[model samples]
Target: MQIPTAAASGRSRLLTSGVALAALSLLLTLHAVPSAADDDTPARGTASMGSGVLAHEGVHGQPAATDRTTQTEGVDVSSHQGEVAWSTLWNSGVKWAYVKATEGTYYRNPYHAQQYNGAYDVGMIRGAYHFATPDTAGGAAQADYFVDRGGAWSKDGRTLPGVLDIEYNPYGDTCYGMTHSQMVGWIRDFLDRYKARTGRNAVIYTSTNWWQQCTGDYSGFASTTPLWIARYASTVGPLPAGWTFHTMWQYTSTGPVVGDHDKFNGALDRVKALAEG
Candidate 1:
């Protein structure tokens, strides 16, 4: 299948106004992973916008405006294991999943493996892999680790948009001891490599602090990537400044799923739209 045209590959979701593109929508296969509102969140992307239109408004050779990601039902896994049943999770009800594939320099994720593959085997179409990035290693390394070990993706090396887990991990040493700039540099380098190998831009998964502390500057690639923001609170609100919009929002963190004992996830309506439209 030819990749849809999104101008310049991946762009910052902030530019999209964080709303679903009502005009054009499509279905994808994604997995459930862990996500949080912090700095170390990783980000990466890769996809040829067949028409470069986000909401049919920006399809003019320009990337589509995710101002709306069609309202998807998603879940993050790395946080809990043995709770969600792999075989029944998707059937119980889940549209897309952001499964954690890698973290820091090592760590392939013990739970993500089964959960990610399970989502696909069960039939969840909207799928993607997430990386837990640290401000120390940068994005490039994270990208490499993910692409190399994330999972059995298109050998053509492509996914709707690969994820960068950009969240601060105080307990982990993956960040090494690099300065803030050094960390962001690594992320940029990773995004670059990911695009070169996969032929698309990478998405950045970050929170308010991570965006300010590690993801600052580097807007040069904003138009080439998307931002998956994790801002959890009492209720869903607008995205942070600079970011036009978020590709996926982790609104709620706890829920019920047949696969997992007690699961946490987001709404599924949008994801269904992404599949239907």
Candidate 2:
């Protein structure tokens, strides 16, 4: 499926971006990403496909995996649709889920409400929402939009901090595509507003390219405002300089989620505590 964009590099997709080209290397390195070995996690009653792989949503669980899971890694289960959500994920042992609450300019995730309700129903804590912010949308407005669609920061049992989906599209064929500083600014703006409204630090979800080429100072940000790195790999080569700890990892693309289809997700361990706080 086609994911939305946050950068303005003039390309319909980021096939040419350094980040995009390196995406495969990154995802393959995710500690829990799927591979050719461990087909699926053995669940009690779920029917398994003859392949010895578990059937979920439309895809089958692969044996070889690094660390993150299709169901537990990314945003809300809403990302996957038309299938058993709560039950499947609950059975699959998902730790947390980030729901795509909103998108650029004017799009809120169609499944935001239902997915939120589903997570609530299953009692999966450590929830977060991603905003497809535009490079040209400016900081303050985008930040406000994030909260506007990010659901209740304090109301819905406390969220695990907000995330900024910074990739391509928003800036769209801009002069130099999207620079590192731009993404940093985007995160800074979003976090500032969120903190002002909720009185808490926000998390930053970025790829290695953005962090390496753009970021230099994460020290100013709170330690608790953990980084959610999106690399789909078995090993992260080496932690990029300057960063300390990450909260989530979008380790793979070969994922199987029940319903619409759970694309792009990661591992979330501290999700519960962060959301509760």
Candidate 3:
């Protein structure tokens, strides 16, 4: 039998070591890669206003309003509430309503017609709100989706301008994995598109903490967009930069009638004025 040379044995060992090392590197890489399920992107059409807020910020006691003579009462609803009891809510003193219309570019609220028309039928000034999913699609695309779905505004005195519900991300990153400037840009895109399509500046629904964290408290939209601040407290605390006063306030998640409750900054006539605009 021929004896294998030392050099040949050394080369064989080196080759084997190289192969083993390569396999180990591949295995490590495979382990480091995240799966599709790991991405935590929210399912289409599932997000709603205050869904993330309620998850991040727990519920608080409904502060007693010494006098609600000037402020108008309202409610916001989503698919979670199903077919809402509009008459019950109206009887309970809700003068206005905001119904979730679309989420991202995929989910349209199935009960939008019932909730939106139901409120209007009950003599409540009603509006549609789009739950923004900034990560799923471009702002303009999502805005188009919203208007196409049910967020369109009309000259009717009962229909309020569509609302852009841009708040905490319930599925993943709080800012939907966007930087502050990017978030602001996305909002501007949506708002601009909505305005072009409907001839009305859309309302912005967001909490102070979320607006500050996600948009760097950018006040550019303040001059044009109506601010719908969400804060579950006795008082509205501090608002996002730029706005001296909130146009509307979402003050409670567990309202007496149904869904989350809100307050228009002014009286019923003012609510009608906003609807007319």
Candidate 4:
């Protein structure tokens, strides 16, 4: 995989430094993101959805807006969800699942096969995701590692594209110690490599706050990649700079199943189209 060496050569140094310092300071003040290895269940109904104004209609345990927009409800899980009963989840009206496949450059989910395959076996549209660790390795290298593990996709119409979970670092340095431009370059590298290997862009999972503070509100990825906004509120909060709409919304961490509840932004057919890609 090729690494970008001079990603920000054309940008003015003064502007870059100012933005980077401000972003770093802001991230420092933000709370550390919860570790996926630990229970994120309680944070489900907590302020991750933001405080006050609950207006969404609950689907099973998922609460979203009552407005009649067609959506397919689903769930996202890591090993933290533990020994998922896919059939039971499927019977609960879940149409899809995004399973955590890999993290950083080294960790691959040990329960990936059981969770992912079981989801497929139970007739649910399935996808895999990489928990990005931009500080640990070059984006291209990490992307390669991710796809090699479970992030690759098939045009089977039942398999959704891989996802890049780029958000608050559960580790130190919320921005992963990279400037906005640098972070964007690393993400670009990963997306490029993933597309080259799998023939489709990966879905980007992020929160509004993280995108603004860490990525300097970069909007370039909006056009090519699909956004999966994780805002546990009555509505998706202000999205990252470019996205006019979210492709998927993760509404709650505490769901009917052993995972986070999510909704595809459109009808079942649209979700199938995404899977077909």
Best by TM-score: 3
Error of 1 at 169 (Å): 2.0
TM values, all candidates: 0.59, 0.62, 0.84, 0.78
- Candidate 4: tens digits of C-alpha lDDT, residues 208-272: 88888889999999999999987776777688999999999988777865688888989899999
Question: The CA-based lDDT of model 4 is what?
Answer: 0.82
Could you give candidate 1's per-residue lDDT for residues 169-209 as a string of tens digits?
43444233557567667767877878876766666665555
Comparing 3 with 4 on lDDT, the higher-scoring candidate is 3
Could you give the C-alpha RMSD of every candidate to the true structure, in order shown? 26.6, 19.6, 6.1, 18.2
TM-score of 4: 0.78
- Candidate 1 C-alpha error for residue 155, in Å: 8.5
TM value for model 1:
0.59
Alpha-carbon deviation at 126 in model 3, angstroms: 0.3
Error of 4 at 194 (Å): 0.3
Can you rank all candidates by TM-score, best first? 3, 4, 2, 1
lDDT of 2 by residue, 1-277 (tens): 8565666444645557767768877776775656645654422212111111112112433322554443244333333342336757766765455666665546566666777667667766635455444444665676677677754477455356666654323223321255656656666776777788777677665555544554543345545466665554463334445666555555444446543122223334345456656
Off by over 4 Å in 3: 1-42, 64-69
Q: How accurate is candidate 1 locally (lDDT)?
A: 0.50
Off by over 4 Å in 4: 1-62
Best by lDDT: 3
Instruction: Give the least accurate 10-residue stretch of model 4, judged by summed lDDT.
Output: 45-54
